[model samples]
Target: MTENEPALDSLTALDSKAPPRRAAVIINPAKSGGPALQGAIFRLCETQGWAEPLWLETTVEDPGTGQARQALEAGVDVVIAAGGDGTVRCVAEVLAGTGTPMGLVPLGTGNLLARNLGVDITDPVSACYDAFNGSDQAIDVVKARLNHSDKEQVFLVMAGLGYDAAIMADTVDVLKDRMGWLAYVEAGIRKLPGKPVKAQISVDGGEPVRRRIRSVMIGNCGRIMGGVEIFPDARIDDGVLDLLVLAPRGRLGWLGVVAGIFGRNKNETESVEYFQGKSAEITLEHEQEFQLDGDHLGTGTHLAVTVEPDSLKIRMSI
Candidate 1:
């Protein structure tokens, strides 16, 4: 080969280099500034020398589960959920155990999973940047089956039964738009007077323990809306599910539950009890309100939850 000519070996090496990675952004077009966010992501991907992202818009009929499966089929490097908690949960349900990492760009009122992952909620551009270039961390995703149903739904944050779910059901959308997480306060107050349902809770297939409970919150992570650490010891990647049972006796019983949640001595009160296990089965006396990741799923009499350890790979800077 001539000295001035390009080396054949170097040319082959250049041609053999891998193609640019691409991302599928499953976004909720209903969110404010959705088009603007998509534009921002398009520009950022171009600047970062990556392939153009495949934009998927979520519809009323299908949130993200279908879109996520589509992304996986396309062999995208990353699947980014660019909406709220519901969208994140739907994408996560599909991506869990699939080996493809999921990214987050919080564009909703309560970015529960993003908040738990320490992703910045205020800045969408920074979030998109991290979605394009970030490290992956394996986290646990909990699967819940209601009313002995054959189908099991996955939740990344928390699943609620009874009063908590009632709060989710009663929360007003207009108030939520104006007040954000505080909108739940109105619902909570309205739900406080409900009767406790007798629950038979079995953890890890152990013998069932009966109790009068107002709510059963199974958490995969620690915090919730308004930065409340309901399960203080909970960890997303811990490979365990944290369960909180609320059983208030009287009008004054809620005070103790509040104290137990916020006070240093959390385990001191019976009104609020915490349990850790790999799986839990709860059978309520009646059909009570049920919710998954803050989205109410109507009423159910039974809920079985199991923790899938390190099943989801979440990509973020932190």
Candidate 2:
């Protein structure tokens, strides 16, 4: 094991004090090497003297939300999401406000939330070890309600509308798998020519502010991939959501925005506008695509989002 890998066997001492009686693991079989990862889960749980966990396999049709809700209702002491960001988000939605502490077994590409929590994503055993012994931290969650023609839905983490969402929808899975987070750069470059769409935004009943924007990112946490500070001051328990609006006027302005990101100056950039509020409402001039936690959420012209402070209980190593 690597130096950063948590010593699961060493943590057995804690198990003697208070054994973990129950755990529900929601595993996504389609994630990379998900089948092999199962053995690690068994070893860790067995070491802790916990019963064989109730295993729920995620199906493409259901995406694990239903399974997670079922597990939560079944009264498991802990619910562990064993997949990528998408899987984590689905489970988090169900566990939100339920007082059930959620854990992560980072088996996803761009495990942003896990990274933010300082969880050991490279080692499944380490993640599981931390889950049982780690303390709980209250994190903020954003409820994004998209008013579609017939119904509405909710999102967690950063939500993107306009150029960034378009890039997410258009990015190829093969390239993403091969290049990892660099695929976003490739996709962003391809979409730069079509950037800067018009939109009107309102923050917590404020007057509608109109602008031509390349992308709008609603952030619950400050860091994105590559340790990029998308919103430098964003806090997971701040009780307020952060908004990063990129409205680059020209190619040079876009270049400046890129430089700002590299320099971690998102909060101080001229082309970027930042806001923190309890809620926000957005309306695009046309039907624009949006993404939540890296998954496309289809195209829509209107979106309403609100923040719930300390809404989710997460097990964190820190």
Candidate 3:
């Protein structure tokens, strides 16, 4: 086995001293580690003095919220989300406001939340151990809804509209598995060459502002691919959210955005603009795709989003 992979032959609940510490793990079977990952799970729990984690598996129909609630009902001290950002959002959404801490094991394509929280993904065993032993911190959560959709979804990292959403919707699963984050680069190349969505956006219930944009990213945690900081001032525990408007651009405009992203100072140039607010409402000229934490939420002409400060309790060192 590789150094990162755990080697466990017979998985069993370890006999431990004193009262057992209880934890629950909600796992997505389709993710990278697959069934073999369970060995690591059992081994980690065995060593951590945690009980054989009230194991719950996510199905194609149910991602993890229900199982997480079930775990909470059973009085688990921590709820661990063992999938990608989507799964993390699901479990976290349910655990929000309950004062229950949620842990993450980065196993999906974009482990954005885990990365932002400083989880060790290269070593699965270490990742699990970190989740089990981490300290507590509360982070902000955003709730978003598309036009004609009555249901609202929760996102922990960032949410987007237009080009960014298209990249997430169009990225192929096999390509993502084979190329990792390079898959997003390839998909962005394809999507960025297209037209930007024209829309009028209003922040914090303010007057409407019109702009033709490549993407509108609302970020709770600002760090993204390649260690680039989209909004340098954005903080996860802050009461507000940061807004980035990536405008219509050709090759040169793309270069300007790249420069702005890598540069130490913020650019208030015509190509990109930044704003901060507690809520945002957008009305699109036409149907544009929407995404949250890298998962597409379908096309919508109207969008509404709001931030809840210190909304979710997270189990992490950061």
RMSD score of candidate 2 (Å): 8.8
Best by TM-score: 1
**Which stretch of 10 consecutive residues in model 2 shows the poorest summed lDDT?**
147-156
Model 1 TM-score relative to the real fold: 0.96
Model 1 per-residue lDDT at 142:
95
The worst-scoring run of ten residues by lDDT in candidate 1 lies at 186-195
Candidates' C-alpha lDDT: 0.92, 0.82, 0.84
Q: Put down candidate 2 lDDT per residue, 1-318, tens digits, no spaces.
A: 899987988777667676457788898888886767777777778888877787899998988789989997778888999888898998888888899988899887788888877789889878988887788899988888785344434455688888879888888889878988888888878888864667899999999899888788899887877787787787888988889788887888887677666565555676778888999998888788889988898988888888888988887587
The digit string of per-residue lDDT tens for model 1 on 1-318 reads 887999999999999999999999999998888878878889999999989999999998999999999999999999999988999999999999999999999988889899988998999889989987899999999999999999999999999999999999899999988999999987888878978989999999999989899999999998999999988788999999999999988878899899888998996897988888999999989899999998889898999999999999998997
TM-score per prediction, in order, is 0.96, 0.89, 0.90
Clashes of each: 0, 0, 0
- List runs of model 3 lying over 4 Å from the truth: 1-18, 249-251
User: Which of 2 and 3 is the better model by lDDT?
Assistant: 3
